[model samples]
Target: MNGAQDLGGMMGFGPVVPEPETLRFHADWEKRALAVTLAAGAMGVWNIDTMRHTRESLPPAEYLSASYYEIWAKALANQLLADGLVSREELREGHAQEPPRPVPRVLQAADVAKTLAAGTQYERAAEAPAAFARGATVRTKVFHPTHHTRLPRYARGKRGVVEAVRGVFVFPDTNAHRQGEHPQWLYTVRFTGPELWGEGADPGLTVSIDAWESYLEAA
Candidate 1:
């Protein structure tokens, strides 16, 4: 595990490095809690470790306001609710008499993993909606949808050149299910802060974001 110490002296926020005794203390505390929680069959107590965007993706207000654990907790709760493992009411109740319900038989982990491994799975079927090609001058669309999207706010509507032609990956725009896994040409779009924020931005700073084909258009 690349725990806290590994993140020291990075660009912005650094990692939390716990001392040896502190780590032992937390581990023992968590072990006891896990035993009790599991014995009680508490719903969704186990934290899910998944990749969220880089800290740079967070809005300035949220970035400073939230703690690392707070962010992780919110994400865990969101997944449980979204997956129907627990209802809003159940969430408020905190401890459930029952274990968190497993996902439906049709979408169980083993089955989903098998499908993914075998290369047959639900995927977005859209093709080529992007108007620009790699190496083309283009602008990121200023999109502010009601749901989750990978289009970072800082880079929106900014002009940048496509740096690379990375092949497609999951489209997080529609939903967390990776609603669209269909292949669309992807690009490493690089924008200078001066270009994105105009005169207020640091002239030498630049940010690169991986933008899907759908989020881009001709400049």
Candidate 2:
């Protein structure tokens, strides 16, 4: 899962320059690209995690070369083709070659406002008590998963203090792969800069990352 998208703390990419707050869509087509991706997603062929994995799974060169919406558009196409919602020929021809496939639901124009406002609820009731408590010292487990994982490479195998319990939620590691939601306790784990980036890192710098319980262990 280590890909070009996980650029945190990575050097040689040059510093990230800030964009103007007023800037939204770089081009008119980008807006349509987002709308199409969202509308297709509303059809429920795949979950958000699956869409994310598709985007992340893009070849390193392709992923790096694409813009934000370009990634979304490419990933959407991949999903459509994989799900049989559209054929490669149809994609190439820009027309349907087969009968329309039934989806779980359709997003109507009027429903867009409410659907976007309501959002998807991921926080589920806990099946058990949280494993770690506030202020507990813990270490992130070193893992190299073949599927999607929310745990970034930088924070792995590092020690941190629990700052907050973020409640149970769908565990993306399994959910993204269509294994199951397999929800786990979420926590805000705060790591000192030195613990992650070594002694030469800024002494005053620290990072708080939302880590699933499975990613952490008692130190």
Candidate 3:
């Protein structure tokens, strides 16, 4: 038969199914962990990008392996353990423990109003001219980075058009890498299937993706 059938025949044990209660509990835990992990991950990334302190004192593994919410929970737990806010035993035993520091009070209405009036806030605005106006041609750079990059591999070296100037945004690719967060003008680049995938592409379909102006070069 197939490779899977051959393997299964060799291994006498079947795929074991958990009891309904156990399965339900695992599912619930997974959901909770996912929510926490994502929040924690965002916070960790934002903290580093913004040059602010992060509660995540642990390595990247805590964020990568945990569920979205669980990542945050793990990071929080790690922070607590590191700062002596909670002990490792407490975490392992799942016990409620004191925070390392006291929670601060929320800002009052007047304070918020004053802060808003001062204009010491951050707002993302587009900063680039739509060099290639609507329907004008452009091409994404064929960039290869040894580390991480925001450009998806599929879009590299593909020809696209300036569909719409989407205004300025904080370029995560730069800021996340500790480069800088200078405003980068954004645009929606549209591509026909043939331009991206060659003759194998379906003629009727098109793909649109949001890309920063800096990511494109003249076709």
Name the candidate that leads on lDDT: 2
Compared with the true structure, what per-residue lDDT tens digits does model 3 show for residues 1-219? 011111111344457666666544355767776544433433333333322122222344443344434544555566545545469877888876654444233345456566446643233754546566777788998776533345666677889888897777766556744677766777789988888777677999888878877788888
- In model 3, the runs with Cα more than 4 Å from the true position are 1-26, 38-123
Model 2 / residue 144 / CA error / Å: 0.6
What is the lDDT, from 0 to 100, of the residue 62 in candidate 2? 96
Better of 1 and 2 by lDDT: 2
Which 10 consecutive positions of candidate 1 have the poorest summed lDDT?
1-10
If scored against the real structure, what TM-score would every candidate get? Answer: 0.57, 0.97, 0.55
lDDT of 3: 0.58
Give the alpha carbon lDDT tens digit for every residue of 88-121 in model 1: 7776887674565653333344454564466523
Off by over 4 Å in 2: none
Q: Clashing residue pairs, candidate 2? A: none
> On a 0 to 1 TM-score scale, where does candidate 3 land against the true structure?
0.55
Instruction: Give the number of colliding residue pairs in candidate 1.
Output: 0
Q: What is the C-alpha lDDT of each candidate?
A: 0.57, 0.92, 0.58
Q: Candidate 3, 52: how far from true, in Å?
A: 18
